[model samples]
Target: MLIIEGAGRWTTPTDGANDWVEHLRMPDLSVGTYCIPAGGLDDQSPHTEDEIYVVTAGQARIVTPDGATEVGPGSVIFVPAGEEHRFDEVTEDLALLVIFGPAYGSRAPAHPAPLRPRS
Candidate 1:
């Protein structure tokens, strides 16, 4: 059995560095902690694998191509692979438990399709 401790140690960004500390990795899944300081920007791009985010602390708004939602402690969110999303307008330090299916970065990055003229 595998075990991890102090998963919440990095609940807030340190020295202005947004941190993502991976704790567990397997063939089918992976887990980690993501911390962004209040007012910090989330510049992460869409991943090739599906993701689940569990808000452990703090508050923020996650904006996706479809819509946006407010997240706080105990909030659980799911994002599909290749979807555009980001967290913004953070009102407090944000800490989240992130899980990726098929393991994070296990798949090749998706390329944007060439635009086609309207028929």
Candidate 2:
């Protein structure tokens, strides 16, 4: 078993314009804590893994291929693989917990039919 205290983690710099800290990343999952300063924006990027973001504090707008959505404290957002997305216009210092990784057998089956190649 692993225990992680968010407050104890060290912040790491990412290319994105926000303060980020890698909290925990086990064999089956990865987690991070992020603080987006007011008016800050995280440059858009795509991911190979699925991800979920839980807003712990502040507010921001998430831009995705589908459209833009408002997220704030208590808001939860899921981002699918290969999605183009980013955060923008953070009203206050935004804090969030992000999780993503290979699904442990405990949760669900890991493999499904392959997706068609992107056009």
Consecutive 10-residue window with the lowest summed lDDT within model 2 = 7-16
How many angstroms is residue 75 displaced in model 2 relative to the true structure, after the best TM-score fit? 0.6
Give candidate 1's TM-score. Answer: 0.85
lDDT per residue, candidate 2, 13-74, as tens digits? 35546776677767778787877777777864677778888888887898998999899888
lDDT of each structure?
0.89, 0.74
Q: Which candidate comes out best when scored by lDDT?
A: 1
Q: Model 2: runs farther than 4 Å from truth?
A: 7-17, 103-119
Best by TM-score: 1
What's the lDDT of the predicted structure labeled candidate 1? 0.89
Q: Please provide, for model 1 over 78-101, each residue's C-alpha lDDT reduced to its tens digit, 9 standing for 90 to 100.
A: 999999999999899999889999
Position 11, candidate 2: lDDT = 44
